[model samples]
Target: MKIHEWQARELFEKYNIPVPRGYLCRNADEVRKAAADIAKPVVVKAQILVAGRGKAGGVKHASSPDEALSIAQDMIGATIKGIKVTSVLVVEAIKPEKELYIGFTIDRAMRAVTLIASSEGGVDLEVLAKTEPEKIYRKNIDPMVGLHPYEAREAAYSIGLSDKSANDFTSICLKIFEIFNSVDADLAESNPLAVRFDGSLVALDSRITLDDNAVFRHREYYQVDEELSPLEMEAHAADLAFVQLDGDIGIIGNGAGLVMATIDVVAHFGGKPANFLDMGGGSSVESVYRAVKICLEQKSLKALFVNILGGITKCDDVANGLVRALKESQLKIPITVRMVGTNEEEGRKILSENGIWYLDSMETAAEAVVKSAYSRN
Candidate 1:
């Protein structure tokens, strides 16, 4: 589950991390009041789950209550990246002497929690990680021993921090690590952890994603984070384990293991998956039909990739449902299918009759769909 930035800031403050004072406002009047209360230059940020809000005009700076109110008027009820904004955060804007980033997340390959620190700023952390990995300082922590102070300091110094700020950053890293473990978070990070002219540090923004499996232990947080995307609500009602993503490729496969592998393969081939939709074991035709329909509901998809390893679920049954869903949908997009196991020939025959391409290898199908998706652009 993803929590909004305001909620993440509250979590940060609870750990004694320095953060700019902010107020969560539902409408323009509250923003005006918050701006007047702060009595300083403030940033009006849209409270949406997606990132890149600033470029989408969901975030703005206001020097006075009037400007803040004007910005909030435009921001509230606006859609950013397909999600409507119902609230805005009016926070005191900080003048930074330098900007840096620090985040804690599970490194699957290392099979441990990874602390990543970067001296670079203004770029997306993910992009930085992919493009300029040399600038990033990484240290994987053993869950049993926890994060060591020396390791934290090593990361801070490697990111080019001075004595005072490095010390504070080390403490912040420890606190973030604590928050990561205690909150059962899948991801927790402060982007642009800023150093002010006076040499004090403050987190300019934060993001936190809790593990869905551990939500039972953190039930209190759901009170404020009850809002779900329309797609997620629909998927939940349909009884599909689905999660929306900001990608153009749609993924569907039988079983959690196969779905995960399909998603990774799509990414490996440079295709972004639009959602995580697991069709589950022994899926009936109707279930497969509904799952495909769910992926089709996302109009942004350029191509759909389906990987099915038939066992108890017959490959031919899944194919009938998949073809039916594609034929019924108005928004006709490219699709690639890879099927193996029981009744593969019948499945291939059904797909071939419908003019949908079939590949036996997941990697080959992933490459085809990725190519089809990018060719459109």
Candidate 2:
């Protein structure tokens, strides 16, 4: 669960972290009012979950209220990285004398919370890690003891901050750690934590990803709209795990591991998977039908691939669902299926009766589907 930047800033404010004066606006009129209230050169930023918003023309500078309104009008309905921007953050555009990066996240490998800091900011951390690994400083917090003040200060000085800014930097890092633990967050980051000309630190950008499993503990935080894609919402309703991707082949499998392996197999055969749909361990006719319907509904899908290795899931049941889906909908795309394990013979018989052939091997089925997709192109 990712929260919008404005919401992240709200969390920061709750923890006494300084942020630029801003207002979340849904329209031009509200933007104009926010700009007037701020009474400074403001930055109009599209409030969306994806990155690279600045490069996608989602961030603009406005010197006056009218300019803010105009920029907000252009951004409100704009799409950035496939997510439509429905809101904008009108914030004071502070000219930073220096910029720094600070973040806290769960370090899965270490099985501990980690604090990461860098002298360089306002850039992608992944690129920084690759290009200048030494610039990134990290400290793993002990779960039993939590993040100590000395450890926070150590990270602050390692980032090469001036003595004047060290205390403020340390304070912010400690607060960020607190926010991370308190909110059950997977990640909480402040990119380009700005140092104003007067030598005060302010968070220029904020990002927070909460742990979805812990949502029950923080019901109020999870009340915000999820902004899920239409297909994703449908999958959620059906209790299936589905993720859309950019490809021509639609994939469905009984388990997450199987679905992931199927995607790898498709890619290995020079084919891309359009989506990942896992019907869970015990798939029923309704689940399979819904998954098939969702995948077939995707635009630009050239072929559908169903790979099932049944253990708890019976192969014949899966075949029944596929045949029912085929009968109910106009499936324009070709389908390739591979079924092995429990009740395989019965499953194969049912598929053959419906004029569909089942492949015995995943490799052959993957190759056939890849060829079919390319031929259609």
Q: State each model's CA lDDT, in order.
A: 0.89, 0.90
Mind giving the per-residue lDDT tens digits that candidate 1 earns over 144-173? 899999999999899999878898999999
Q: Per-residue alpha-carbon lDDT of model 2 for 1-377, expressed as tens digits? A: 88789989999999999999999999999999999999999999998887788999989999999999888888899888787889999999999998899999888999999899999999999999999999999999998899989998999889898776888999999998898989899999999998888778999999999998898888777743346678788888788899999998999999898899999999999999999999998788788888888878788889999999999888998999999998887777788999998888998899999988679798899999999888965
Total clashing pairs for each candidate:
0, 0
- TM-score to native of every candidate shown: 0.71, 0.89
Model 1 segments more than 4 A misplaced? 222-232, 241-253, 256-277, 283-377
Q: What is the C-alpha RMSD of each candidate to the true structure, in Å?
A: 6.6, 2.7
Instruction: Estimate the overall C-alpha local distance difference test score of candidate 1.
Output: 0.89
Local error of candidate 2 at residue 287 (angstroms):
0.9
Deviation in Å, model 2, residue 86 alpha carbon: 1.9
Top candidate (TM-score): 2
